[model samples]
Every structure is written in C-alpha cells, then in structure tokens.
Target: MESIFHEKQEGSLCAQHCLNNLLQGEYFSPVELSSIAHQLDEEERMRMAEGGVQTEEYRTFLQQPSGNMDDSGFFSIQVISNALGVWGLEIILFNSREYQQLRIDPIHEKAFICNYKEHWFTVRKLGQQWFNLNSLLTGPELISDTYLALFLAQLQQEGYSIFVIRGNLPDCEADQILRIMRVEQQQRPKLIGEDEAQRMSVQPVSDTPVPGDEAPLDEDEEELRKALALSRQHMEVEDEEADLRRAIQLSMQGSSDPTSPNAVVTAGSSHESGSSEETLTAEELRRRRQAYFDRQQQAHDSSTAGEVKDSGTKPNQ
Candidate 1:
C-alpha cells in the first residue's frame, strides 16, 4: 500500500535504511547505527587487549580500521543484530545448523534481514503480504506468497547472508490497512534512478509505443530496426517535400530561379541518351508523395502480417 515507508538509497546508508524499513518507520538514524557500530568496535578492541598489550596480534589489530563499520556508512551484521535486540527481537542466522534443523519454511517468518556485498535490506511480512524493502528499489516490491521462498533462495544463491527476525514488528499504518483488503501491483517498481539512467542513454526515443514486456531478443531488436528505418524514411520524405515546396513558393512569387537544381521549370531534357524527363511540377510532386506513402504503408502492413504469422498467434484484428 501507499503507506509503506520506503527509503530510497542515499550514500551507503543501507544499514540505516534496512533497520528503519524493517521497523516500518524512521525508527533509527545514521547516528544510532554508528553508535552501535562504535560500541561493537570498542568491545572487540578490549577483547584483543586481553591477549596482552605488547602482543603482535594486538598491535596489528590496533593498526587496522574498525571491522564493525567503514567510511561508506556500512555497518556489520553484528551491529544490525544488536540494533534489533533493542526492540526485544531476536535475530537468527537462517543458514545455521540449529535453525535449519527445525525445517521451518521462510514464508512463515515475520521478517528477514538480507545482506549482499555490503548492501542491506529487509523482506518483511506487513499484515498478510510480504514486501521487499530494498532501499535501492523505487518503492516496496510486493512479493507473492508463492514467490517469497524462491526470492530468498535466489538471494542466498547470490551470496547473501539472510537472518530471520523472530518477534512482533512495530505497528504501522501499511500493515494495519493491508490486513483488511489486499492490493495488487499492476506494474513492478523500477530500481531507484533506473528510469533516469535510461533517459541519459544515447539512443533517440522512438515514436512507436513499445510494449513494456517486449522481450530483449531478436523480435524486439527487429522492431527497433524497423523503427529506425521508418525514422529515416520520414526524414527523407520531409526533406524532398520541403525542397518541392520551396520551388512552388518561388514559382508563385514570379522570381523563380529556373537554373536552380530544385526549380520546377516548364521543360527539361538530358543529352546523354537524347532522352527526356518531365518537369517536376508541384501537382506531380504531391501525387508522387501520396504514391510513396501508399507504398510505405503496404510494406509496413505486409511486414506486420508476416511477423504475426511467424509468431504463431492469430491476428486479433
């Protein structure tokens, strides 16, 4: 539903986004998660100091940066686990032997925190539906019950560490509303900045409205090829028509340049083979343009019919 609080990606604050989205509100901020990370770092530092202050390992660890966080605003999973603990929620490693032994289905879980590379996101069950609250997405992605397990498995395959959230999530308007009535997504949301990136590409936009579901295959490429050809065809027609019109206007103005290449004089002849060519009058040019357009239309219709036949579908029209 529209009430879902989705934070579009900004900087490397995915950990902040992940926790806040999981809690279904702006429950946590960068400062809060960073504080948690620093605390974890201090604890690790004190543990290393126990190995004796002068030890090689302790000195080497001191020289290195904090493992719990980095300059890019990334927080370790330990930080996330600790942050969730603040809400009385337990975090379980999904792939751990103890949890895997239970044979529990992922769809029944209330929430999941997924991490890949350094990006973090939440796949949470709001009311009766599950939504992928990835900060990189334009908005919350509705994941069908049947596809939830498959989606998690795909993330796991792609080297993501998935943790199960075991507790009641904070109350939110989206969860309260979706529980009463379901919402269906007609079109999936694109990734954040995806449309803008596409607009910046070098390709000129086509006049034809391409179907959104067009496959990226030979068929789609062939259609684009036709569109390019049509673009060039129209450009050629317009240029020739403009030249003829200029000659027509000049002729009516009584200052026509008869020797000009585009001028439509009363007579014309070629000496090479003693052959003759008709003067290209304005009326003749209009007739020729109509004929040219008719030929183009017939060619386009034939191409469409051939494509429909090849695709093994009945022509609906």
Candidate 2:
C-alpha cells in the first residue's frame, strides 16, 4: 500500500489527504474533493431548512477545526462516501465502535480511514502487520495491534466518530450503490433538537442558497486549483531520482536540526541507547550521526548507479 502525507498543508485537511491516498489511481485532486464537500454541506443545509430544523449544532460541527467548512477541509463520512460514488467507486462504511460488525479479513487489500478526535488518518493490514499512514508522520509507521485497540478506545472515549471505508468498485456497482444511498438519504428523518427549536422560535429562518446554484470560486479554492495544477505537473515527471533527491534533502535538514519534527525517534526500539526522557551521551550521539551519514552515502550511490543504468539503456538517436 502507498502512503501520502499532508506535508506543509494545514492540519484541517488530513481527511482530504487520506482520501487522496485511498483512491490513488482515480487522481481526485484535493480541490475537487473540497468542492464536493462544500456542495454536500450546502445540500444538508437546504434539507434542514426545508424540514424547519435549525442547524446550529450541525453548523458548529462544520466550523470546528477538523471540519472547517469554509476551508473545505473537513467532511462527514456520508459526504465523502457519496463523493466517492460520484467518482465511480462503491464505499462500504462501518462504525469503528462495533468491532464485531467489522470485516477485518476482507480488508487485506482495502483502505481503512480512521478518525481520532480532531485528526484523521489511515491504516492498512498487510500479512499480519498494520501500517499507520497518519499525516503527521514522515512515512507509514508500523503499529501493533495492541496500540491500535488502545487508540480506538481513546477515540471512543473522546466522543469522536470513527468510520472504516471499503472503496473502489466496478462502475455499474457504484451506480447502484449511489442510487441506494440517495434513496436512504431522502427517507432519513431530520430531527430538530430542543435547543435548536427554542433558538429558532426567537429568530427568523436564515437565508439559504438555492440548490444547484453556482458560486464564483473563492480565494481558498483558487489557491487549491493552482496547487493541484502544480501537483499534476510534478506527477507527470516524477521518478526514482526525484524521490531520492527529496529524501536526501529531508535527511540533511533533519540532521542539521535535532529538534526537527522529522528527527528520528528511537524511543522504544530494541536498539535504543537512551531513555525517552534522557538526552543521548556524546559518544552515542556521534555513533548515531555516523550511522545516519553511512545510510545517506549508500542511498546516494544507489541512486547514482540507477541513473547511470537508465542512461545506458537509452537507444542512441
């Protein structure tokens, strides 16, 4: 499985990044996902308005850092699943709290989206191990089953929602799934909370945008479009050499700043020479530094050899 990180982007879009990784071949840019999310939010608002259901709680939920509606970063699982359907994929969602209902055996080759508090991440099982693709990490990290269970329990305790997705389906199947979701959505009741009712009784209904209305692109959307264009250009020319160069640069930067987020953390490793709360001794730190440089040299030589091999394979014009 492939893992992608949010990189320098704001934390609000971790879910968007996770989705991008999940549907890798589809190439749905973050901008496109954000647009779909915004449209879905608008649709939900319209539904609430029609049903005379005040949307204070829902609006609050959207405005939170994890689900910033204005930034087009956060999204509900239903909205995401619906958008995936539009992209020609079938999504099966499972509430994480109900472990018995989860089909872990069939998830071997599938993507799993996990939600924890205000953060969103992904994990996948390969063989007997699980790899975490949390956006905050530099790369996919190995996670133990014990850690996974504890993490899920913590999320549940925090009143956070969890969803597991099984995606990528045949076009015909996707169409059928989308139709079913639409029917279910229409039949779902829009419940009005007592607080919402009391608040709405004193205030007039807020004006809502008409369904299917097109709005001009905002600043955030414009920036996202530019980013997506640049990303496409990069993807067109990306190769192993480019990856090696990036890896080397990141390694150098991390070495130069021991306090950097990318710095290697050997806290719980069997080879850890220092305690988590203790600083490394001078000799131990030097040894680590030497080891890092040795790895960098090996990678540099390998990348150079690959480049030479590729050049030799090219036919003479």
Candidate 3:
C-alpha cells in the first residue's frame, strides 16, 4: 500500500497541502480515522509517519469529538487506495468545480470490486480531470454491497455526499447487494444539488397536457419500479441459497472478458454468436429462484425446531 503512496515529486508540498485540506475538510471525520489508524501495523504506522502523515492538521482534526459535523474545518479531498491492494476510493472536494482524476499504473492489474455510496452517479474522464463519486470499502470486504451502503450512509451523516457507481451486476446479486446496504442508506435522504433545487423551485406552468409535450406514461417502457420492487424480494431468496462457488466462477469468467457487461453473464444462443449482451434462459432463472426458496424454507424449519427445543413456542400435538 505504501508503494502507491510514493509522493509526487513535483507537488510535494502541494500534495501535503492537499492532504492537510482533506484532513481538515468538512466532509471528513478525523476522529473516525484515528480509530481506524489505531488498528494499523508497525510498518503501516511508519509509512504514515515518514510521509508526515501525522500533522497538526490531523491532530486538530482529531481534537473534535466524534459525530460533530458543525465543527469540521475546510474541505479536503484525495483519491487513495487503502493498505489493502484490492480497494480504492476517489475523494473530491464538494465545492471544487474541477474534477480530479487518477489512473492506475498500467503494468499492474487486478479485479477491483468497485462500489460507492450516497446517490447514484456517473463517471467520466476528460484530459487530466476525472469526475466520479466517493467511496470507502477496501480489500475483500469491498466486495459486499451491504458494506458499501453502510459506508455511504455514515459519510452522508458526516455531511459528505455520495454517488454510487452501478457497474454490471446480476439483477439477483444486485438485489442482495442493496439489502446489505439498506440499513446504512436509510439514514440518508435523496440528495439534491444546486441545479436540481433550482429546477424544483421553478414549477412548470401547466399540469394539463401540453401541445408538444406528452406525459411520460404515453411512452411504452418497462415498469421498472414495480419490477425492481419484486426483483428485490426475489433476490433476497437468491442470496440465502447463492452458490458461492458458482458466483466466484462467474466472477472470474466475467473478469477475463473485460468487455462483458455483467459480472455474471447468462449463457445463451446469442452468447455463441459472440453478441456482447448476456442473457439467462427461463429454465436457469427458475432453477435459481427455486433454489432460493428452498434455502429460505430450510432456514425457517431450523428456526422453528430451535424454538420448539427451547420451549420458546409451543409445538402442535
């Protein structure tokens, strides 16, 4: 991890300045980080110290007690991958109009389980600038959606806005992912930006049908909201019975293609023709659904048996 922290030769002080700003920023919590830092090893600790990682800026940051956002100092932001090589988070100052971008050292490669918190956001890169939302999941734990959601919720409460990146995940897996993140996300309300607020304040002149503009319902589209709600329930069942081995196998295969849209592509006739899209057969979908329900039933049975043994609930004669 320290290998990646190799200081910028050109922006030595500027980088430090940036670090100081981030440590003092309104969107960050230094007290929380101190708790995190206490868990570091000797080598990691030395790396931070040698890098002047400990400074008055951070000290001042820690002085404030946990959970107080009002006392946070200036806005500081940096994109950093944690000590664990597998994870990365892109940090950006909320007020800064310019986007900061970073790319990996071309020679190194690994499958990053990219996730983010806050609101749904998109990513784009132009010249040296990069635009994306922030996140804080690292290493193996980074793979879980639940963890990603929790981190976002925590940051939101600290006054940092989140923008989640939605890459290609199976609908089933994606549903389970949200469940894990649901608790953390509950604390955060839907965030609106300045532009959105302005738009909201400016009410449209007419709710009645306009000449050229028809309501969205006129156009045929999937009932995404309804389907998603059902899908959410469907996915919970799948998570209980999800074959970890099969999921891993699919993940590995998905990584190899690089061009594939989803982490787990459904094999089909279109797949044989080299079409980019992935599809699942009805049979496959049904099988997964069945497996999920079966798992849930088994769990329910076990819980009932335990209740009976403990005499927590009376059994039927």
Candidate 4:
C-alpha cells in the first residue's frame, strides 16, 4: 500500500490528498486537479448568481469533461468517480451509513475514504488488519475494526458521512499484478517493537464497569488521555470567553445612559430629539453592537501590529 499527505494543503485539499495517494505516480497531479476544480467552481458560482436555469442538461454538467474535476475543496462521489475514470478505472462507491455488508475480496487492494467532521483520511484493509493514512499523522497506523466502527459512528452522529472506494481491475493481468503486490507486502519483515505492539493492540471497554475494577494504563495511553482532557478544557474556556465578549458587546448597545461605561451611540443618534437616556430598539441595538465589535477588532489588530513591530526592532544592546 502507498500513502501521501497534503502537508500545508491539508486544510483545503484533503480530497486532493486522498486522490493523490490513490493515484500515485500518475501523469496527473493533485495540484492540477485542484486548479481545474477551482476554475469550474468559480464559473458555476457565477452562472448561479446570474439566475441560470437548472435544466436536465444543466444537472448533467458535472458529468461533462470540462466540469468533471470541479469541486470546492471537498470532492463529491461523482467527481471522484469521474477522475478515476480518466485513468481507466471504474469506481464502486459504498456509503457507510447504509446498513449493508460489503462484498470485497480480502486479497485485492482497496482504498477507503473516511470522513469525520468534514475532514477526510484514507484507509486500507489487509486480511483482518486495517491501517489508517491520516494526513496529520507521521505515517500509516494500525487500527482495529472495532475502533474504526466506533469512530465512524461518532462522525455519523455529528452529521458527517463516510464513503468506501473500490476500483475494478481492467483485466486479469491487473488482478494478477495486485495479487503479487499483496504477496510482497505480506512477505515484508515485521518491525513491531514492544511500544509499537502495545499501541497497535486494542483494549475492549464494557458498557458497565464493575466496582474496584480498572485496567492499568500504559505510558502512551496515559499521555493521550491527559492531552485529550487538556484540549477539551481549552475549548470550553474559549467558548465561555466568546459568549462573555458577545454579552458585553450587546449590553453596551442596550444601555440608555450616554455617560454609562457600556453606552453605545450610532451616527446622528446624539442629534435626535429624544433625551440622552433613551433606550434603543432591538434592531438598533444589534446594529450598534456589530459596529462596536468591528471597531474593537480594528483597534485590537492595530495594537497587535504595533507590538509585532516593536518586537521586531532590536533595542540598543
């Protein structure tokens, strides 16, 4: 099996990354596909903005050669299928949400595109073992079927979907070639050490744990648990801070006293016939809050730039 990462392009080109991994050493590159997709997307957006009619022919635009590779960061199943078709490979797509057993040959090479929270990663199965080629990771990591299923289930709950990709071999020669490749992979030397072996092993967790029963955690497992907890805590703190900032901004807009610390005034408000202590309407308050935040953001950005400039300038040392 082969694996590749999008590196700096992971955030916007995950679909392209997966495609590159699947079509390594091909004439076409992921960069080319991305460029083509972006151009088509821009054209389509322009047409839609001009109130272009959606006829049956318009619906099939994606099937046309000019628009086949077009996408907006994420590739639809049709886009992926059409791209693969260019290389003479037929795509067989399966949705993970559908409750149907996949009929696949264990020995044949296959690539699985797993989606979680709009991020994509590739996976492959060899016999009973599964390997994950997540772009963020250093390399392929061994994973368990139970872990894969649980991960997919959590993603589905968050409104994400998974798609499995299987390409049809062109002829018997291609099938034999893949079988040989699999045999070579199986014959590769085993390099798992004690730490790696521990990491690859999956410990089952029961729904109900008996009192006073707990399994000992390995060093790696303990560190991972601590990291996850710290990350969750940091996210919760950020959410609270954002909510508090929004509340303060809104409160400033609603204050009636012009002299109050939280008072906000729009243009021409002071020239109105109403008294200085007049409360604003909900719509006016919202607009004022938005303007206040915009000003605050600009000020913050200016201060940050000045700080950066000062830091960059060396003191007389």
Candidate 5:
C-alpha cells in the first residue's frame, strides 16, 4: 500500500485521480485534464462551425458551458479518453458487445476505470492480484482473483460504467515485487471515513457514552470535535457525503421488507439515511455521523504527527 501511488479525493477532481491511479503515478492533474477538456471543447466548436457559425445552433452552443469540463473540476469521458490516449493506452467499455465477445474476465485485464454518477475510480491489477484503488477509500483494497468478476458485476448493478484499460502500463515497484513474492492482507481497507465507525461499533462494553446521546462516544466526541475543526485544512466533504449516501442506501436495502419486525425507522433522519425510517435507528445515524468526523480526525492527526516528526520534536513511530 505504501509503495503504490494514490491521490486522495479533493473537491470533485476524481477524473484526475482516476487517470493517475490507472497509470500508477502522478501522471495527470486537474490542470492537465482541464486542458484536455478545453482542447476537446475546441474540436467540438470547430465541428459546430462547420454546421455554420452564423446559425442559431452555433450561437447557442457558444453561449453554453463546456460540455467536456465543469467548474467543480469534473471532466467528461471524452477528456479522460484523450488523456489516456496521450499515454498510448485505450479504454474498452466492459459491457460493450465487443468486450463481451472477447470473453476476457475482469482479473485478466490490467486496469479499469469506473464512473458512477460523476465520481471516477480505478481498479487495477498490480503484481498478480487486483486492487480497488478508489480514492474514496482509506487505502488500496485487495481484491481476490475469484471475486474480481463478481466485483465488476456488482459495480454494473450499482450503475457504474466500467472501462477496461488496454496497452502497456508504465512500470512501478508494487507491481514488480507482487509479481514475485505476493503479499497477503490481514484486513481489508474500509472507505476513507468508515474505520472509526467500525471501531466504535466494537468497543468494549465499558466504553463511556456521550451525555444526552444514545450512541457511545467515549473519547470519540473529542475526536469528532477535533476532526470537524480540522476539516477545513485536511479533508474534502464531497467523498464523505458520498459514503453517507451509500451507507443510507445499504440501510434502506436492509429495511426494505415492510413486514419485518425492525422495519419502522424514524422519519426525518431517514431522508438522509435512506427512505425507510426503519432502516437506521437514530443511534445508528449518530454513529455514522461520528464516522464521518472520525475520518477527518485521523487524517489531521496523521498529518500533524508527520510535521512533528519532521521537526525532530517526536521520533517516528
């Protein structure tokens, strides 16, 4: 994980992260991708001009925003394709007829780029194994060979468009070592803000609870406060919101059975947790909120500790 290059999410710049992760380096940036988008926009404008720049259609097109890029740092698939073309790599849609005809399994591919809504991510094979190199996660998630096909199927079910990366990938250390002596993961990585929730869920019974709250907080309350304050400097809220939406969706699925005994969830919070109020208890909702903040706290602490060690005031642990 340490050897693999990964860029955490910043604003809505996932397209940039997706490209770099696919190539296994800082091979792309928001500025570079934006340039690609602008070039694409220029090409499109040229085509529209062929249709006659003096026409109403061309006039309207000039007034509209760039279809290839947005103010929030989003770049369209066209921009992503162009950027990969620069690296001599190409993308093949996983669900395309041409891809289906090839009968190539997910693990057989070198890398994948997935898009759901506007968020972009990479799942690439390094060494002899597959990894979900999503920037929304705390670290690279090791994927077993047997599970790779199932994973891609699940993503498609979730409305993600998966593209297989084709061509020679630039060499990197993680791939070389893993090709020889492979490493085994004792635990899987969680979504970036999910670790604290897991820890809180399994605390010993002796852990103290926050006053006036049903969920246990113990020292977690302090951590949350620290995290909330540090967020301006250390984290982006977009990815946390995405995780929250996912958790709520899972909760809704669990509570979908109206006939089930546990189906009655509280109404207001249910809007955010999922449509079914019965899905997440108010206690669970608080815990999920805690998880979001706990993520920020961890990132902030890690950064601060690094600065301290660099100053020679603290030894590297």
Candidate 6:
C-alpha cells in the first residue's frame, strides 16, 4: 500500500526543486558516481518490480539495446572510482511526462504511470535495498540493465548524482533513503481523516496477559469456524457474482446459436445422468435452479440454528 498524496509530496517537491535548480545552473556532480557503480554487480545495476518484468506484454522493451552502452560503461567506471564513503545508491525514475503522467487506469483501476520513465527503474530512490534482477534474467539481459545505468548517467549529466552505499542498512529502505537525503518520513499518508488515522494507529490489546501464549494458533480452528458458517448460510453471495456472470454469458451463447434461434440447452450436465442435449424452457430451468438453491439454504439454516441461538445468549452464573 502506498500513499500517493501524502507520501509523494516530498519527492515531488524535491523533483520540482531539482528541476528549478537545474534551470539556474546550480547543479554539481560528485566525481565518485562512477566509483560507486563499480562496487555493484551487473545484476544489482537495475531497479525493483519494474513493470516490464511483471507484465509479459511490456517485456519487449528490455530486449533492444540502447546506443549509449559505451557511455554507460564509462559512467559505471566513474561510479566505481568514487565508491568510498558512499552510504547507498538509488535510481530515481520519472516518466517523460513527470508527475502529470501519474494516473490510475480505468480498466484495471490500479495506480500506474507515477514514475517519470516509461519503464521500471524510472524512479530510483535508494537505501539498504537488496534485490537481485540477475537471477530472474536469462543470459546477459543487457538491454534493461544497460539502459537503466544509462538513464542514471543522463540524470547525472543533467546535475543529478547516483551512487551505491556500503554496509548494512534498514529494512524500510525507502524511508531510510529519504531520511539520508534529509527528507522527513511520512506516516501512513493514505489515512484521510484524524479519526481514520487514530483508528489505524491503535491496536487491540488485552488487559490480562495470558502466560505461555507462545504456542501458535491451531491452523484449523479459525478456518473450520468460517467454513462451517459458510456452509450453514448457503447464501454465498460473493460466489454468486461469478456464477451469474457465467450464466449470462451462457444465455447469450444459447440465444446466438442459429440452430436454436430462441435458446439452446448447453451440453454437459454438471450433476448425475440427465438430459444433455434436451432443450429446456428458460423459465423452467431458472425455477429448478432456484428451488435447488432454496433447499440448500433451508438445510443450512436448520443445521446452524443452535449456534445462532448460542451466539445471542448472555453468560450466566
């Protein structure tokens, strides 16, 4: 979970300031970026969870080599030269459109295009980061890694510094990276209201501490309880959504079949030996299905009657 509005404010501000500073020619590059690049393995020279790797469709982007390999290789050499006292390195990616491109796709309804680059490693914020892109790639897989280094090099040429840090670092590398860069940490930024924030901040605690509570919970206990309730309710409203969608699709298929103009019975009966090709009246089939569901619901309700009553009872001396 990420807080787009709250968590990104600092980075967005930093990026803006960097842009402004670059405009005024107030940029300075540390000579050590190349030295830092040398300390990193060829595998570590990439970004994490890049969309190109996750989505099969975008994978083709990494197959072609960029023309700046020699320049990137030179940049890597320079980073390795100044590797001392470096705490960490991150690759900050920005799409060509910058923040304006940040959007949630309506089809998937997921947050995307937040970074500046069209691909992964577009935003490299670094600290205590441990990821291995090498294991996932077969052969050299040079295009992605090469272009990533090249991109950082370009940013460096534009007055941005990129380097790797040495020694152990914290698990919360993102926050740690910001902190190292003299940035403030954001606390659960997605929480909109004070009440929401307070609710999330509080955890359930028991007044009485049970001793020897070291044993793990019985794996089946909670699962069994839930399963029993699900069986008893027979209401499976959640499951009905998918079934309804499938039924609609089947109905459409049946209606479109030229042989059965109005409707056609789908082959393959789900239960027992029954009429496989016998066309059924739409109304009749629906009634039968409803009756079957009703019977299951009745049986479930009866079986869980005792538990339902127990749940409503008050404790007595």
TM-score of each: 0.64, 0.39, 0.25, 0.37, 0.63, 0.19
Indicate the TM-score of model 4: 0.37
Encode model 1's per-residue lDDT on 97-155: one tens digit a residue.
67766767677899998876677889999889888888877788888775565455435
Report the C-alpha lDDT of model 4 over 237-307, residue by residue, as the tens digit. Answer: 12223333333333322233422333443322233566234344434543544565476677777987788
Candidate lDDT values, in order: 0.70, 0.45, 0.29, 0.44, 0.69, 0.30
**In model 1, where is the ten-residue run with the lowest total lDDT?**
227-236
Query: Between prediction 2 and prediction 5, which has the larger TM-score?
Result: 5
| lDDT tens digits by residue: candidate 6, 194-228 | 24434544646666755533333255433422322
| Model 3 CA RMSD to the hidden true structure, in angstroms | 19.3
> Where's the lowest-lDDT run of ten residues in candidate 3?
134-143
After aligning candidate 1 to the native by TM-score, how far in Å is the CA of 65 from where it should be?
0.2
Tell me the TM-score of model 6: 0.19
Number of the top TM-score candidate: 1
**lDDT, residue 45, candidate 5:** 95
Candidate 5 versus the native: TM-score?
A: 0.63
RMSD of each: 25.3, 18.8, 19.3, 24.2, 15.5, 23.4
Write down the TM-score for model 2: 0.39
Q: Considering summed lDDT, which 10 consecutive residues are worst modelled in model 4?
A: 228-237
Please provide, for model 3 over 1-317, each residue's C-alpha lDDT reduced to its tens digit, 9 standing for 90 to 100: 11111112121122222222222222223454333334333334455456465686545544544331112221111122221111233333321223212322211211111212111122221112221111111100111232222222222222333222112311233234434443212122111132344454475877676454433431212232221122122222233333432332232233323223322334422345574434443334445545766887888889989989898777998
Q: What is the lDDT of residue 171 in candidate 2?
A: 32
